[model samples]
Target chain A: MSAKKLLVGIFDDDHTLIHAIEHIRHDGYKVGEVFTPFPVHGLEHALGLRPTKLHTAGFMFGATGTTFALSFITWVSTLSYPNNFGGKPFFSLPSWIPITFEMTVLFAAWGMTLSFYYLCKLYPGKQPKIVDPRTTDHLFSMTFDLDGKDEAYIEKLSSLLKAQGAIEVYIKEL
Target chain B: MSHFESPLREPLITGNKTWKKITDDIVVNTTGDIKPLWLIATLISAAVAAFGVFCIGWEVCYGIGTWGANKTVGWAWDITNFVWWIGIGHAGTLISAILLLFRQKWRTGVNRAAEAMTIFAVVCAGLFPVFHMGRVWDAFFIFPLPNTRGPLWQNFNSPLLWDVFAISTYFSVSLLFWYTGLVPDFGTIRDQAKPGSIRWKIYNVLSFGWVGEAKHWERWESLSLILAGLSTPLVLSVHTIVSFDFATSIVPGWHTTILPPYFVAGAIFSGFAMVLTLMLVARKVMNLEDYITIAHVESMNKILLLTGSMVGTAYLTELFVAWYSGSMYEQYAFANRALGPLAWSYWTMMFCNLIFPQFFWSKKLRRSIAFTFFTSIVVNIGMWFERFVIIVTSLYRDYLPSSWIDYRPTWVEVGIYVGTGGIFMTLFLLFSRFFPVVAIAEVKSILKISGDQARAEQWDEVKDDDVYKTLEK
Candidate 1:
């Protein structure tokens, strides 16, 4: 990937950040990514991001767990080596419910979380690409790729950001 | 930028709190210097934990004979502590998962610490059964993995094996949920720490390189919601399986179908009490009264009242069923519990688990920190006795008068029990000192909508009529 020039705008409040993203997008300048100290309501919609499908992944994983648990337990109790337990049936479904349910939840939670980490490129000791450190503290930030934009265009975007209540605006190479 | 909240709803966060203030107040507990009081407490807890460990070592080396269990009472204090500790763990998941799904905003104040309590409680709980196996080295025999000895498989129909799966699943899932929530808060601390310092590096790795990007937060929120959905039922099932351990047995008192719901309610009751016991001391010691306010205390006390009532009702129902069923053995079991040699323990469980929590019915007592703290401890003790009453009383005097005998825990057993307490405290203290005790990011998210200053300042911005007008449109 080629290094790119980026325009970054930092705001002190979540509301201001949301408003800035709206105005920036309305002006037809492509918004790259925005970061905040905490999840800001309505900010994703303002950035035109789609809702995540992580829950679908969770469902699939849970289904896999259920199937695996039922089959394994059934195989172990019946085909592999069946013993007369309380003179009950070989495949006792009620007794197997608890383990199956637990396996379902276990798979769904861990699988979804690991998938999330994979999608987000998040892992222990991985260095984050931080535009502004304050974005994780008290500030909200919006970044725009200006890879092929002229100085005049950059100036116009910076002025728009200021007008939209940006606390600070600057340029950086990423 | 603005959202609707009923004016009558009390602020979840008290005092004027900004994002910066929230970060400083919570993060300082971890990033700043450790307090002398915390050090002293840790030392004491560590010492207790060490003694507990030595007791375990003695039991392992000398065999399970070191315990007080005999022919009549195969399970006494060890199993009692196991059920008690596991029950205490329920509150954390309940607060984190169930309350989150219900949109009870008050949970944000206590969820993080409560979830940590869940993890530590499970750890302490897991020790009993493992050590009770006598040959701790052969504990792997519990698992159904293929082995050299005849390839003997565990009985899938057994409740004990179900407990192995249930508890292990509960522990791992709770850990994931807790650590997932911690990632953003760790990011906040990582940003606050001096760059390239040890604190910074440690927090950075712990945070898993979270940068709080909008897309990442969106995904984070999704993951949390799904985890909460999974944990709600998982938490309930854990206790249900625990109850199955007894209910599936043919013992008169143990064979009742009411065991599942009774155990779950009792677990939640005990769990909430433990959370209150810890949070009350923690908020005071950490000077976090603003975040974990009286409203939070009252909310928790209300739950204690509800679950306490459920437990009380279960106790009464058990007695009624015992008599109403007209089964002589069952009737005899209930009679023996109430009027037999171990009647004191039975009454203690009733008073502590049932009667003491009823004081919360009074609004004043419910909100009083001193009363809540005292009742919290009382409820915990009561819960321990509930298990004791259920296990020992039922076992010691079963159908056979020839084998009837009294059960008592030897010093080694008691030491191990006390040792688990030490271990729990040690883990909790270390957590509070080194980790953000409160979910800082979550607190910040709710600050605008439910904070005292935010509400007071925005009081005139949107009228209730205007909100209604918008709704009408």
Candidate 2:
């Protein structure tokens, strides 16, 4: 979303791409984004991205499920259509544990996954704008915004990427 | 960053695997021409499934009487199959969730297919309870829906109701977890497909437009960890709740405190067996030996041995408890199971589940694919009999002497059971053909760490000081 004109560099390996990112950033050039086929360990730290808060969101969703299940079961057993089964108490908490735990898992899993998809803009029909198709296969790619830069700056960055072991370098409007 | 793996540990992915090679090996199964063997297997399974469908339809049209459920032996093959299938499903979640929590790297090879098996098994498991309702049309009565007739709610205390919630939730969460894992792999396939082609279009949609950005992968990893955490207990609780269906009852054999843990162990035992049965065939048929190597098979066999021993211990414990309680009724139930008319099934369960898996204690047998496959099937048969022996033996002879009656499954009942087997195979064959049976991306992630060639290289470059420095960093 930053710019249509991008300087894209593709690396054949994740380790090289990670080192390239650190070197590029160390040299005072802002790396736009790196795309990979799989999750490369330590790549996020190399990119200076914040740790994901998905787990926090999962906790909240699980809590929501617990509250809903408990309150719903209690209300059903007590106020609404209460029935004495084998002379047991109206609101039996021990008996409610299984369903409550199930609801907690159900809501947490579904809620966290849906929220993840939302945050990542992943949906059934979304046509992804990929920098390089190989990024999802065997390649790791990094893009740099070239909209405001002059040709000299682009040349310097391209050479730097090549020196840092970029297998391919190109300019593309995406 | 370099990965540090012990040189002594067996590589998870054998062969000199690179990312492209891994993709080609797995993706070709989906994108390339279908093998004649797969097509034939699919056709046979489909035909069986069709006959099963016809039997179920016939039962639905006529009545529950089409099955062999009389006054005494009320729940025979139906509940047995349900519990058996549900138990079989446990292996998938265990491999995906529990192994993941423990950081077991070998799971990557079999997790995808195992998870798929879980979904299919649950689907097969669900059919029994729904159709067992007899009037299948009134299946909704199980749900605690707000009703107009006195707003009658399902009894909250009933384990049956808990079962309803547990099974449905288990199915849904497993589906979510499986689909979530599949997304990135779909992206791998989509990226390889020819642009604007139908294969590309389909995979593109299935992938949910995964671009594999670092941030997205970060979230993906986080989500996977949390889901694994949630599913760990969820999987355990599902079988526990299922056991509660019988454990909560007042019947002699069914009413026992050991049922939950015993059932869970047996479930995992049978589930791993099923996984072995499927994966051994899949690896051979799909030519995925490099991914699903003997090490994977041996590891799974180890699990079967452990869970099998646990189940054996449970069987012995149940008998001991029955004898120690000094309750004649409980003693009678255990005695009836072993020496009664249905003792054949009970002994079959003991031999298959308890005695057969003991063979896995031998390393030579455990590592042998052929032997492992044989024992896996035996274990599943044993588990089915275990369920059958518990459900029928306990129910057939009630407290009243007049209620004692032998039960036999009608042709329809046998047909449905066979049909579910057909259905499971059909779905699995289709999944194997269409989807990446192995998780491509996850395998790739571990390639640098656990791949045979990658590890060899890492062993040379990795040093004690380097590992410590990396740790510090």
Candidate 3:
């Protein structure tokens, strides 16, 4: 599926990339993915991307962690073994605060990281579909799927990209 | 430009470097032959660490009897080192996680090194507590996992057990947070590496095929934010729990309600000191003076001063409460820390932590590299003594006067302490060799935000004038 030809527009700066993103979307072309050396502020809105739901996932993971920690402590201290230490109550809520807090953080960190990798389709030893190596350096690149677009429209898109300060444009297949 | 971006906002990466130059500057260290000084430093550190391991082996063979810890001072050096190393570990996360959350741009220059310090310090920290347990092989028993021993579930009510969970969680989460931040920097290096070279391939795998896709950056930003948020509280909790190990006990000096906040503040204070110590040496050795500028040093000095005063305040509060409460045990503990046999240590800590940092109130001393370097070392010593005072002075004299004993560390314990330093330096030196010491991507992100436009407006009226010339030092 990744073998399909991709039209990539390379911009010299993030400002030009933002302009090109707006221009390409306005010209009624389906904008695919844009790559930059860093997160260009407002590039998401420029591309009309929906807000990511990863934070929702993070909150859920954090909630689950808190519940699990409290439940495990309660079950183990009360139901499971019930050994008394220092004459404090078996379900010592104060002592439980540290572990509960630790668990919540542990779960959220791991959960959010794994969710990020999964959502981004990232894995160890995976081959990156790079349009240009410079995309990770200084150049900001936008890629378009050329599978269904007509040649004339593609040419128009290229000219539009050039007009918006694109350093170069190229076609490639991943 | 952010309204917050101004002359006061330090040019995080100095030299008004371009993205390519930033990448080039940092990647050079990773790709180059090991420098002679690095080799010497690493060798010395590795040797010290090896000696430490030998000491551990000796102690294991001879038993905990090898240490000077007696019945009265059961935790003299072992737990003291544990808390000390852990306290030193706090600065990295505070810089990487807390500073990131606050959007402190100056952090970009120093966070990479600080995070590396954190991982190494935690590794060093974890070593003491485990070895302090006489039965080193049975260390796994600290965890609550089911074992062959009948119905002996680890006590959930124990603060020691909470420490087991807290330190491990803190270590794991810190490692993740550190690695996550490294991904983009690693990707930058991978892209710059000679294609098909070993360096390229290694970074390629390490970078997880990161291509800096706008969407990936979006998710990356979210992950960083959430991790920072998570780590902010986690760093606080780890130290608070470490304090709980003492506070929950009935020991006079250990039982104060103020211990938690005091420990956390002291941890951050010490941690920053360690950061400055490593960073100052690092900036000089790695020729990163431009990247880690004087302003960066001054910024950290300000933090040291703030946290130092807080620590001093906590000290006075503890003393005040002890005196006001009329608890002879508490009063004796506070008084003994000052006028006791360990009076020298107490004064050293006070002078180093409280008096020394007061010099930072003068902006000149704060910005002076030599002064900052000296105080960073002094502050770390002060913090270590702070732990010693808390643990040893308190434990030295319990309720029973007859059981009082003066604790002195054996050679083996001293070796192990020195070994942890060796291990920390060895790991850090190796990290500096292999990893992007300055976060390339983050520095690049803020190059325009802080470095370029601010410097351009402040100096050069000509918009086209390259600002690098103005940064000539």
Q: Residue B240 deviation, candidate 1, in Å?
A: 0.5
Order the numbered candidates by DockQ, best leading: 1, 2, 3
Where does candidate 2 stray beyond 4 Å? A1-3, B458-473
B439: Cα error in model 2, Å: 0.5
Candidate 2, TM-score vs. the true structure? 0.97
- Residue-wise C-alpha lDDT for candidate 1, range B191-268, written one tens digit per residue: 998789998899999999999999999999999999998999999999999999999899999999999999999999
Lowest-lDDT window of 10 residues in candidate 2 chain B?
B463-472
lDDT of 3 at B156: 73
The candidate, 1 or 3, that scores higher on lDDT is: 1
Per-model chain B TM-scores are 0.97, 0.97, 0.95
The A-chain TM-scores of all the candidates are 0.97, 0.97, 0.95
Over 4 Å off, model 1: A1-3, B458-473
- Scoring each candidate complex against the real one, what DockQ results? 0.85, 0.85, 0.79
lDDT (tens digit, per residue) of candidate 3 on A26-121 = 978888888888778889999998889999999999889999999988988998889867687887887788888888888888999999999998
Quote the lDDT for B145 in model 2: 82
Each prediction's TM-score against the native?
0.97, 0.97, 0.96
